[model samples]
Target: MDPQSALPAQLVRLAQEESFSPQRVLDAVHAALAPRTGVRRAEVLAHERGRLVVVARAGEAGPVPGACATFTLRHGGAELGLLHLHGGDPSTVDRAVGAAAGHHLAVALRDVTTAREQAELHRVTDAVRRLFEEGVRAVSVEAAGRLLVAVAADVLGTERAAVMLVAPDTRVTHVLGVGLPEELEQRLAASLLGRLARDSPAWQRAALTGGPDVVDAGGGPPGRPGGGVHSHRLRSKLKLPLMSAEGLVGTAVCGDVTRSRTWTPADRVLARRLALQGAVVVDNARLRELEQAHLRQLEHRAFHDQLTGLPNRAALLGALGDALDPVTGDGGVALLLIDLDGFKRVNDTLGHHSGDVLLQQVAVRLRELLPAGATGARLGGDELAVALAGPAADLAADLARAVHARLGEPYVIEGRTVRTGASVGIARAPRDATDTTGLLRAADEAMYRAKRAGDGPRTAR
Candidate 1:
């Protein structure tokens, strides 16, 4: 074979023969090139701290120092290994030929290194994605935070990770810890999370700036205007702010007990990514909780009077309907309707604020005098109804007299003395008409009669 052509031919053959292991490839190159280079044996030198150390050799024996020509093998800007051609006359392998061979072998040497790096990237990405999905599926803010630290510990290869959730007022609501040291974990879990957010410079900086922080001290991360704010129980930590479009929601702290665990570029990348995904999960869960609370409040307002905080006309009618249900045997329920006779005059005299105060006081009085199984409800302005469930006949008479006396009591409104009177009317189911509306009508007419006659209470006929 032609000498020039044989070199490239051997190069291709080497590629085919070796399975891309660094040590094995070096041995293969030595085998293929020894006879042609005249320097018939070789040693592979690893680049370490600006010096090359002979790590492997192949063929007749290792090369003699200063008796060989060296080719620096490099991949990109980084040096991989060196090829030292040994024995015979080194001039037989021209500089150009040796350099070419060195370049090709360098590419081969770094093949596994590059492949492993890419594989690590893929692995990190997959782990982060899996955790993100799991966090999104979490049922509550606390659950999502717990899942975050648990999975992050395993994926990021750490024993301590804490999630600090911040409230809108910039208070630390929770600090959830997983795999933390005993003392520090307990402090963060039970004591520290409730502290003001400003106490931790590392956390607040990351939160406000929406960036990352490295706290490399034992006393804890520094504060904005002061030295280390508090003991984070961390020798070194990476604090990643969990940001949302709404703002900084929290911070995720991944740390170790010693400064020996340096936070690498890849570690920072993975932690920041996990923090962002976790922020979304936590933010969504919190928003859902807020929305549900608001909906419950709306439902309450729907069925209740905002002014006096009693069941409104609609709720009262609904309850009365339930009481009148044949399945419940009429509930033997009786209705007592009371109308404050002087409410409109007070509204005209003292303004609506004082009027509202009077009505609230009236409701309090009526509620206190109510029978054991009674419900007190406000049927719009100045008209209130009470339902007493199967009370003794004497109890019914007592409730009416109590209503008339208690509701007639004077009230103090905005430092002014005021008095009001309630006209009471009583009606019973199946006796004073069978339906809810009819019972209400009977009670209304009787209440008007009592008001006109100065009677304390008039039962529906």
Candidate 2:
């Protein structure tokens, strides 16, 4: 190969090799030129720390006065180094050779920079994957949101990250954050998303569009901040919408507190993914709460009377059984079974609708007369039971009288006054019967006796 052409070839080889070191390439350049061109000596000199240094040198020259030629190499219009030929002044071919080498050097530097960036990106991607896995495993929405913000802040290399919950009422309920003081984070969220809760278009755009956006407080163009006041000292923001099948749930916000930051594509992608995960988490939480509420309603219906909102027959029986138990049962339980004497007469005189109103009034009176630690339940059809604890037999008798009096009070049914009389039969645990069924049977018998005698109250013997 021609001596001048070989220099370019050497540059190509160096550029193709991995770990392209400037010193190594310079050494190769010198070695290739050593055979011809009377170049007894050659060196690659480049500026380092504001001073030129011989990066690579080959061969030796005893003396060469005014015989050296320095060829300045440039890349991307920036001066990088000079190729020094020591044997004699260079011709056009030597200058061309140095220019080719400089071009390859520029390409090599660019390749190295690209490779480093790619490696860093892969690391960031791995972090995101780990975060995704963690988010998927979280059982609660709050927990999942916390994990997302923490992971997103780390992955995006941002100052702060937050998950803001946008309630259906268009209010910001909760702000979950990472790497920020609670007060500042709250203020920051309120400034950005609080506006969304009101009449701000930024939030609507993000939520309706269901994508990520970068907003600069300075109101400058993309990646540039010209001049303006950053109201919160927040120079830049990246926000994405939290969405579910229902609609937009909330938003995931990331802020740069120190400087004006231009969000990269990777940052936007991470925000979108975090928002998506957050939506799923928030939706699941809402669904779980709704399910729990429905279950509670079912439980209430199962144990309560639908008509009067009191404990029904089955529930009262269960409670009575519990009261009869030796352990975990109340001390000295008194059972009173009351039957309204004139309830049937009232039902016949007025309509069943009026009967229902009377029954409701009766329930209310029974409840109002019940003492502390006592329970009132509607057994069925104007027959109600009351269980009281820690009261002597005499006190139980007095309570039964109070119940009768309360029930006997005038009830306004369908815009007319109505009256009823109550017959009470009282039974005490261990005095009447220890078992639930026996106690209930004794109470029932006593109540019938009260009705037969046509008295106010009767106690079991």
Candidate 3:
């Protein structure tokens, strides 16, 4: 095609191209100008991170044979960089073509920059989504909070990230951190709290209005009065509130300590996203914890004596059953049932409260006498039960002696001193009876026999 006819078309095509790229536009400019202006080379340099970076260049750049022209690439009235044309002069055609190419390059560079930023934002959004999913999947509050801080640290590219949960009394609980020492993390939390008053702007915004607060101390000297001491070595700080429908539950803190950092809009957005998801995870974990605690309490109440805090008859039977399971019963098992002696007289004289205290004391002595692989439980008023993994004989004798010694010593209930003795009976699995019910019955019968015969202890037949 003739150069004159092609020039207008080339310029028009460059103008109309939707897929704008810095290098593609530079190449097209060189092709169009080399033919018309006899330009041997063209180069586009863009300013990046305080320096000019060569973005695209076309044709060999040795030396210009004629006049060379350089034009600044401007976008939105600000100079982006320089566009240079070699072997060129300011003839009306050269100037017009160079200016037009410069304009295209400027617009294309801006488009590519924006596209890059948008792509990055999408990636960050995806990552934040995954972080929330992991937090939600975590089985415990500690695990969830750790995941939150770790993810925040990685995403923010900060030296330290931490989570602080506030209690109703304004005290902090469960302070956790990533990339920081436990002691230092604790200190950081303490220091931050010391600076944060209930009425402070950060607290008010986060707890009341649900806004993020940031403090950036750009790589400059510390402005606070105490210099290195009060600054806590932190140059930049970002705070996001962990909010729920009930209000603020906690705060997430991101800090840059090694160097100062300018908080970008993108960084702020990331902080907010993390806090929003983290709050839900934290709340869920806490609620689960409360539920678990409630369940444990119910189980305790169902299978334990409220007065003595010992396993009740039901729990004792369940334990005996477990010990006598066919797979594990080879070890053999022993059951001891004990009844307090002369306990009715103490109750009749001193009152039921004193009886209750003496029962509690008897329970404690039984617990002290129990060895490893043995469990102590309360059968009911004035009666106790013991289950041991090994065979009885010597073990049962030792336990009976210990209980007699401890119970015979004395009891202090509501500042009153009393005395009592325990009648213990022994039953053995496979020897006396292998099942829970049979073992309990044998032990009970032996205990009664001991009491009636005035014997210190007795064994089942």
- The prediction achieving the highest lDDT against the true structure is 3
Query: What C-alpha lDDT does candidate 1 achieve relative to the native structure?
Result: 0.74
Stretches off by above 4 angstroms in model 2 are 1-200, 216-235, 256-264, 369-372, 389-398, 452-455
Give the local distance difference test score of model 3.
0.76
Q: How close is candidate 3 to the true structure, as a TM-score?
A: 0.81
TM-score of candidate 1 to 2 decimals: 0.62
lDDT of 1 by residue, 261-375 (tens): 6565666677778778878888887887778789989988999999998989888888788788888743586888889988998999999988989988988887788766777
Instruction: Note the residue pairs that clash in candidate 2.
Output: none
TM-score of every candidate? 0.62, 0.61, 0.81
Candidate 3: residue 422 lDDT (0-100): 80
Model 3 weakest lDDT span, ten residues long: 222-231
Measured by TM-score, how close is model 2 to the native structure? Answer: 0.61
Off by over 4 Å in 1: 1-154, 167-200, 207-209, 215-232, 256-260, 282-290, 293-297, 321-336, 348-351, 365-375, 387-405, 424-435, 442-461
- Model 3 / residue 434 / CA error / Å: 1.4
Candidate 3, 459: how far from true, in Å? 1.4
